[model samples]
Target: MKTKIILVIIIVLCTFFIGMMLFIKYYSPKEKSNQLLSNVSVVDGKQIISITAKGGYFPRITNAKADIPTTIKLNTKATFDCSSAIVIPGINYRSYLPPSGETIIDIPSQKAGSSMNGTCSMGMYGFVINFN
Candidate 1:
């Protein structure tokens, strides 16, 4: 019957759309907002690394110089999600970022060829800073 044929077509279309959504959500590479990324810089003998936090950390990976005073400048804008609760295990740093603002954290100079990792409180989002 025509009803049976139409039903089959509907089912096929639904399945195909669901499959595409799943593939895009799980298999795709998700990185950043792109427009918000800021370049790292040094000033007055201090290295400042800028990172944006929202749904997740932008520029999930970063590279910086080693053996210098370093400051991690975290920026958040209207961020109220779990990503706002950041945890930097390498330096034993943990805190909740403001809904919209900047938070600066300082640490001693890192050794060459070292890396530091930071993640959300729930471990769902993270970023890494590699020293060279």
Candidate 2:
């Protein structure tokens, strides 16, 4: 009886340890690429040029705005540059983003159909460029 109890206790402890190990392995956080949005539009004419950052993490843009020559509008603040900006894929244009707390960019209507891309702290996020 004593031997049986000891054996049962050892099995129970082993099962508990195995369960804990699996839980930790499954639930542990790992580094992952940040989520991106599809086809963010700024205005019509303007296009995103390039995004730069000092770190690998996303860069927050402040007082973001879109400019089509003289027209400019306030946009929402983004956790990263392209996190809020829109791209059209294949376009070779970029925007001069301001350093404020606003996010969102407005592209000119005339340039809406062309391919464009947004700049991110990590890399370029393309949108609406391969729709031909």
| Highest-lDDT candidate | 1
Candidate 1 root-mean-square deviation in Å:
8.8
- Predict model 1's lDDT versus the native: 0.91
Per-residue CA lDDT of model 2 for 1-132, tens digit only, reads 999999999999999999999877666532122123212234454443223222221223312223332122334343355434433233344443444443333334333233333444235542222111
What is the Å distance of residue 26 in model 1 from its true position?
A: 34
List residue ranges in candidate 1 displaced over 4 A: 1-38
Consecutive 10-residue window with the lowest summed lDDT within model 2:
31-40
- lDDT, candidate 2, at 93: 43
Each prediction's Cα lDDT score? 0.91, 0.38
Per-model C-alpha RMSD: 8.8, 10.3
| After superposition, candidate 2 runs with Cα above 4 Å error | 27-102, 106-132
Number of the predicted model whose TM-score against the real structure is largest? 1
